[model samples]
Every structure is written in structure tokens, then in C-alpha cells.
Target: MNAKKKDPIKSLGIYCHVPFCVKKCAYCDFCSFSGQNSQTIADYFKALQQEIRSFALARFNSDVGDLAFPVVDTIYFGGGTPSSVSPEYIQKTMAVINEVFTVSEAAEKTIEINPGTLSASKAESYKAAGFNRVSVGLQVWQDELLKMLGRVHQQSDFIQCMEILRSVGFNNISVDVMYGLPGQKLEDLTATLAELMAFSPTHLSCYSLILEAGTPMTNLVKAGRLVLPSEDLEREMHWTIDRFLKAHGYSHYEISSYCRPGYESRHNLKYWEMVPYLGFGLGASGFYNGVRSVNTSDLKEYGRLIAAGKSPAKYEPPMSEGELMSEWMFLGLRKLNGIDDADFKKQFNRSFFAIYQEAIDSLLKAELLVQDGSVLRLTPKGQDFENQVSLAFF
Candidate 1:
């Protein structure tokens, strides 16, 4: 594993899933567990470390053929609440990464935390371990809404979390906010944004709640115990957020994300841009060399496979040219600035319009898409109906 590589290296992104949480939110279906014993937690981290080492040592074969070791430029630590774990685990895992891969000196290292799970000590440990960015999940500012959403933390917890992270010298902070809650109102959403703006986070991800099947929240809605905002009201809320954030100096860079200048989520951008990334930990997904792989979601199964010195991930075949082109259009359109036809041609070696001229013409006639110089972007109307526009490419 210590041997150097002969093949040329490619810049990559690394996503490490921390699948432990203090509690699972009612709406969360992500592969994470709460109430696991200390030993189980310990075992999981050991297996995770082993998985990382094995990937680094392997020839990294895929349908696209043999590839060189990746030089990681962005490392992201996400869900169930990375802050819920002991910082020692994170530090050790990072040590394994640095030992195996060629991490860029200026890599953007980020970790996601929930309110009430962070402390001065944990923040300090993360800082010392080379994490330069933190994303705090606040959900909503109202205590009642937080409770309704099954979040364990209160509004005060978020306030305290911000204070501690700032005091520990973490300036690249991103906050998560949710709208379209069961009982959320326009005023409530506005209040949450106004209060959060006072903290001046570098990035914000405002999302509309989607009721996933089998989740407690979805069952409640199905049984009519809870009610969501109407379509008209939800539409208003979206525009309100767009106007409010734009007025306050944040650029709407992506469909669901806004940020200050030069502060985009570098790791997340990799996903939209089709850049290669490797995912580790239970149920994590990775894409590289035109192949996609997802690790087993069952923790025990993942452990057994790793313990047996076997790969735990299931790999999909290389994506076809049509699949790649379709994905490039839809994913690229998620950005506010939209996709460039020239860049598309450069990658696929075919004219963008030559393939999708009919779809583009239809959307253009409907006033949902506009061709600005050489770029194809969504109109204001198209932004409101983004899903429909993105699906047109498919």
C-alpha cells in the first residue's frame, strides 16, 4: 500500500459518510443508526478504515478499465450527523486518507453537523484534523416546527452551535433551511431566513420538503393528520426565498443552493459537474471512470464483506453515451448560469444542438428555456418548473 503509482493521477472528490447519529429524524430514510452500543460504533470505524486502505491498494479496475490512484481535491463528511461521533474517529479516518491518497494541500475539507451535537472540543478537533468548512443543519428557526419535524435540537441549540463554531475559527459555514413544512407559513419562513442572515453564513441550502414513502412524516400526511402548504402557497414561498436571498447579497448559484462570492460547495459541485468521486462508509455511493457503485446499506453485511477482505460495493456498468449526454444536460442545467453548448461539444465531440434540437426548440417555444449567446439557461418561468425542464432532456 506504500508503493507509489506509475499511471497518471486524476483529481477526485472523496465523500465519507458518518452513519451514526444521536437520533434519526422522522423523515430521514438515509442509512444511519442511533442507539448503537459503543463497541458497534468502534467496529464500524475499524471496518471503514480497512475499506479505505483496500481501495487505495487495489488496481481500481472498472468498466472504463484500469485507472491510477486519485489525487483528492475535496473531501466531504456527511450524514447522519458527523458531529454526533467522537472527533477521534474522524481524525483517525482522515489520517488513513492522507496516508493512502495524494490529497491536495488546498483541498476543501467539509463536515456536516447538527445543532446540539457540536461542542467547542469537537470543533477544535475537527479544525486540527484539517476540516476547513462546516455545514450546520438548523431545519427551521421555530421550536414548534423543529418538534413537528422530529429534530432533537431546539432553536437555542442552533444559536449556541453557531457561537461555538465561530469561536473555534470556522468561518466557512453553511446552514440548511427547510420550507414547505406541514404548518409552515410565509412569515415563518421569512423569519427563519432573516434570523439566519444575521449570522452571515458563507453558504445556504434552502430545500422544499419532499415526503418520501415509508417515512413517518409521509404516513402522517397520508392519514391526513398533517397538512402541507398548498401548491400556490408553496410556489410563493419559493419566489419569496429567491427574492429575499438575492436582495441580501447571496448568488443563487444552483437550484437549491445560494452562496457568497467564491464560496460554492466545491465537493457538491463535483456531483453536478460529473467529476469523479469515491464514497466510503455504509451505503455510500461513488462514481468514477464512467461507472457507478454503491456500498451495501446493511451495516452488518458491510462489516462481513470487509472483514472477509472482499469489496462491499456493487458496481453498475459504464454509462452509455446517451446516458452521459442526457445527464450532462440536466445536471448542468441545475446551475443558474446553465450549460454551455461549446463545452458540451468539447466533451462529447458532437454538437449539443445536433442531438437535442427538437427538445430545445419545444422548450424555447414554450418560453421555458432561452438560448443566451452560446449558453442554454432556464427562464424565470422555467426555474419555477425546473423538474419539468430537467426531465425534458431525458
Candidate 2:
């Protein structure tokens, strides 16, 4: 095998999946089960730590080649609810991480929390555990909507959570919210926005509701029990959020992500920047060098493989350079700022203008793309047609 083929990207982000929850949300299609998930939380953490240690050793043998080192730049704990883990569990994970990887002195360590699960003590403990950032999913402010979403927390709980987060010295807080639900109105989104902005979180990730197959939400849609707003209405609502947030000094760096200046998500940027990060645990996917791989989604299988001292990965393949380049365009265009021409040229040693001339011409002709210097970004019209513009790359 070629040595060049095995070299991963420079930076490392370790994503630890904590797939346990108190109650499953109605619209949730994630790899989470309420009681069943909690049963294995402790064991999963143990497996995850061992997996990271193995990956670190492999990287030392493969990528580093000559050095004894752990080169993780970020550590992200995401899940059904990472904060739902007992404080001791979180501490144990951090301890394992410290023992294995040489985390950056200023690494962006983060953990996801739900309002009901996160408390002042836990928040402070997380801070002490080296988690500098926390993202809380406060999906909707309306109690009715919260109930409908089957969220275990209330609007007051969200406020209380934020207060606790502040008291616990979590400065880099992120708020996650959603829109475009079957029963959601534009006014409802406005109310949600008002509540979120009042908290002045450093970062916000806004996701449109996606009805995944096998979920109750999908069943409702198929059964005609749910009627989603038309695409035009959804786009309109998205644009409204975009405009409002931009006006309020939130950097619309990504399609669904906004941040205060200097607060853009570093771990997420690793993805769009086409940097490789290790994904450990069930259902986690990662891109390293030109290769992409995903771990088995089954928790039992994951544990079995880890216990056997093996990667839980189901499939791993090296992507062709063309495929990698296409993915670069795909991911980069999702950022509102657009991709840089020079970076593309440097990476592929070819001009993007020459490569996708017809697509570019057609997009600009349709007034969907605004070409400013060597940069190309979607116009408001293009944002409305983002899917079509993205398809141009493929």
C-alpha cells in the first residue's frame, strides 16, 4: 500500500457519541432509545475511550510514523444528551482522553446538553472537566410545541439552564433550535427567535425539521396526519431567520449556523474545511485524507468490536481525488461565504471555472450566483435555490 494514501489530515477532532436519553423526542430519528439507551451508557463510554486510545495508537503507527504522540485538536461529546451522563462518567471520559491524546492547549472541548438534564453543578463540573463549550437544545419556546415535540424540558427550564450555564462559567455557549415543523407558523418562529437572541449565545445552529423514515414523524406524513408547509413557505421562513440573525450581528457563516464574531464552531469548520477528524462510537462517520468511513450503528456491535480490540468501522474506502474535490465543493458551498478560488486551485491544481464552466454560467445567468472577485456565493435568489446550486457540483 502507498504511504501517501494513509496520511490523514493535520488537525484532529475526537467526537464521543453519548447515545442515551430520558425520553425519545417525537420527531427524533437519531440512534437513540430511552430506557434501552441508558442501559449501555456506562459501557459505551468505556468502549469509546478504548476506541480513541486505539485510534491514537494507530495514527502514531500509520500517520506519525516516527513519533510517539497524540494529536487531537478538539474533543466533542455529542449525543442523545451528553449532559445526561453522570458527572463521574464525563470525568472518566476526560481522564481517558488526557491519558491517550495530546489535546491542544487551547482545544475547543464541547458537550451537548438538554435543558432538563443540565444543572449548575453539572455545568460547573463540565467546565472543570475541560469542556469549555456547551450546546443546549432549546428547540422551541412555546410549551405546547415543546410538549408536541416530546421534549422533556419546558421554556422556563431553558431559561433556568442558560442561567446555570452562565453561573458555571460557560462563556462559549451554543443554542440549538429548529424550524419548519408541520404545525409551525412563521410567527411561531419569530417568537422562538426572539427568545433565543435574548440569551445572546455565542453560537446558534438552526436546523429545519427533517422527517426521517422509520420515525413517528415520517409515519404521520405518510398517513396524511401531518401536512408540511410548502417548500416556498419553508424557504421564506428560512430567509426570515437568516435576515434577522444577520442584522443582529450573528455571522451567517454556514447555511444553518450563526455565530457571534470569532465564535464560529471550530469542530464543524473542520468538516467544511475538508479536514479529517476521527469519529469513534456507533453511527459516527469521518473523512481522513481522501478516505471516508463510518462505524457500525449498532451499539452491541460497536461494543463487541471494541472489546475485541478492533475498530467498530463497518466500511472504509479511499475516495478518488475527483470525488474528494467534489465533496469539497459540496461542503464548502454550504457555507454562506462560499468557497475560495485560490484554495480550490491549490488543492486540485485546476481551475474550478474551467472544471464546472457550464454550471457556473447557468447559475450566474439565472442570477442565483454572485461572482465577486475570485469568490462565488449564492445570492438571496441562489439561497432560495441552494439545492439546485449544490447539485451543480455533482
Candidate 3:
């Protein structure tokens, strides 16, 4: 056995990628595009079932079977849009997973639903099929900014979708909200927050817009056709969301996600804590058995690989002990509580000060961090410039 692959306290989560959506959003750089009139989704699910079956076979083939992750405690259906496919598709997918792996009865099962693709019947069907949580894309509440962000659903559509889920008795619902879009104003954010808070979702995720290089949004900005909020305004927008959500009794568990007490997302927490998880689709990533891998992003190439009875894993990097310790510190800082200094020493058999002596000393002098006992956390300014502080740990 590879000593580094030894199991730890963290449990595994399963992520099933639904790579189809009704319409592609303008600024989305994810592996998503239009899926109307395309049977690609259903075909991919069939291939995914095959992959799950292979996982079961691989488990049974292992020399030490019981030590393997025989049960998945959380299953996250991420996307494109899980709702675009029929409830029957999801049911079948769950069936295959049940047959292949042991699933915890209390497992947190979630599906991402796009507002334009959801209906009351489908929402109820998901609940019946054991989906305890639902996330809907309501990126912006204003119709004008919605159009600017190239979202397909109207503000009314989002309202209707939320109403449908609420009517179906879904209490654990989360909505996605975005900031820093072209022509967005402070009033725009306040209005959107007000409208969404009216629905009283259990969770909310506020994201800042990122204009990736190859996206059309970048092109418009380069041509001087689109305008974004100034740096000062952007900072204010972030601070406003942080303040409002906290006052409303939501926990900012991570940078972008906020939830009412006891309503935090279980599946996503696995990633932030650097726990082992499995990924099963094109462009998805997994960290398991001390090896991390990503599937190919190209739809055509991914489909081909799966059809040929392959798992389509790419860039499978095995992490070293020192590397994992560093990652534990780096990724854990993304949370509000920051990393455990004692945990770092136990894992590395060396003090945290041994590696990050200069960086920690510098940040402390700059007043960018606050240490309460052994917990080292970023100050407000440091959280705003997280990429810079996080680099110090490395």
C-alpha cells in the first residue's frame, strides 16, 4: 500500500456532472453549451452508469475491499442544468448509483436547477427520488442586468421557479446571485437582494463576475462596448453582501456561499476541506486515493472515450505529503475560520512556522490577519485580497 493513500477523518462526496443546458450564458466559461434537440445528455448518462458499474467492479477487485470508500455520503448533481433532463433520467441515474455503491440514508443529495428548465412536477419528483436540496440559477433579479449577463430566464421566470419549489415543500433551496456585471449599480444589488430575500431561501451564493479571456464578454470589454463597476464600487458591493447576509442570520461558510444556520452545503464543503471525492463526467475533477484527476472538457472527445469503455481521466496527479499539507492550509483559508495550526504540524511533523515563517511575520506586521489562540484568520482586507494572502502559505 502507498503510505500516503492512507484514509483519514474526511468522508467522500460524489459529483455527477450534467453537461447539458437549455441555453449557454454569455459569460459562462464552464463546459456547457446549448442542448436543445440533443440526445447527448441521455447518451452521456448511459455512459456514466457504465462508469459507476466499473467503479463497483474496481472496488470488488481491490485486495483490501472494506477499506475502499464503499459508501457515498453526499451526491451532488452539478451542471449545465440537472433539470433540463427529465426526472426519469435522474431516477435512472440514482438507480444505477444505488446498485453500485452503498449510499447513506442521511446522505445529502442535491440537484442544480435552471429557472427556465424547472416545473412543479419535476421539483416534486426530485424530492420523491430523495433529493434533499435544490439550487436554482437566479444570477440577477433585474431583467436589464439579466439580459446583460446573457441569462435565458427572466426575472419573472425566476420568481415562478422559486414559487414552484416552495409550493412543492422544498425548504432547503439555494439561489445563485451575481455581481460586477456591466452597467450594474449599487441599487441593482440592493434591489435584487431584497427580492430574493423575500422568498426566504435557506441558502444563497453571491458570485462576482469573471470575464475569462476567450469569452465574448471579454471581447465586448476590449472593444470598449461594455462597462463594469469601478474597483471601489466592486469592493463596496462585496462588503454590502457580507454585511446584509450576516445581519439576516446567514453563515458565510466560504467565500461565495451563505446559508442559514444548519443549512450549509455538505457536498461543496468536501472540496474546500480538501477531502477525497469522485467526479464522473466531462470536464469534472476528482480527488481520491491520493490521486487527483480531471476528465477531458471537449464534448466530442469525452463521449468518444466513454463509449470506448474508458473513464476518461486526465492529469491524474498524485499528491505528496508536503504538497497535501500546503494544500490543506491554502484551501482551508478560503473558509472564514481559516486553517488549524496544530493540524498542519501533526500532518507534516514540522511546525507551520518552519515553512511560512517570513510570510506569517509579514502578514501579522501588516495587520492582514488576526490570531485568536491557534486559529489564524484573514482580516477583512485580507479576505478581499485572498489570492495574495493565500500565496503566502505556499
Best by lDDT: 1
Candidate lDDT scores, in order, read 0.90, 0.83, 0.81
- Model 2 error, position 165 (Å): 0.3
Candidate 2 residue 215 C-alpha distance from true site, Å: 0.9
- Tens digits of per-residue lDDT, candidate 2, 155-196, equal 999999999988888889999988888788899988998878
Which ranges in model 3 have alpha carbons more than 4 Å from their true place? 1-10, 64-66
lDDT at position 252, candidate 1: 95
- Highest-TM-score candidate: 1
Alpha-carbon lDDT of model 3: 0.81
Task: Extract clashing residue pairs from model 3.
Answer: none
lDDT by residue for model 1 over 1-394, one digit each (tens)? 4523546478899999989989878788888899988898889999999998888777453334355766789999997889998999999999898887888899999999999798999999999999999999998999999999889899999999999999999999999999999999999999999999989999999999999889999999999999999988988988899999999999999989999999999999999989999999999999988888999999999999999999989999999999999999999888989999899988999988889999999889988889997799988888888888888899
For model 2, the run of ten residues with the poorest summed lDDT? 1-10
Q: Order the candidates by TM-score, highest first.
A: 1, 3, 2
Q: Candidate 3: deviation at residue 187, Å?
A: 0.7
Off by over 4 Å in 1: 1-8, 60-67
Deviation in Å, model 2, residue 358 alpha carbon: 2.0
Error of 1 at 241 (Å): 1.0
Poorly placed runs, candidate 2 (over 4 Å): 1-9, 37-39, 61-70
lDDT of 3 by residue, 57-121 (tens): 56544675535444578999898888988888888888777667667788899999989888988
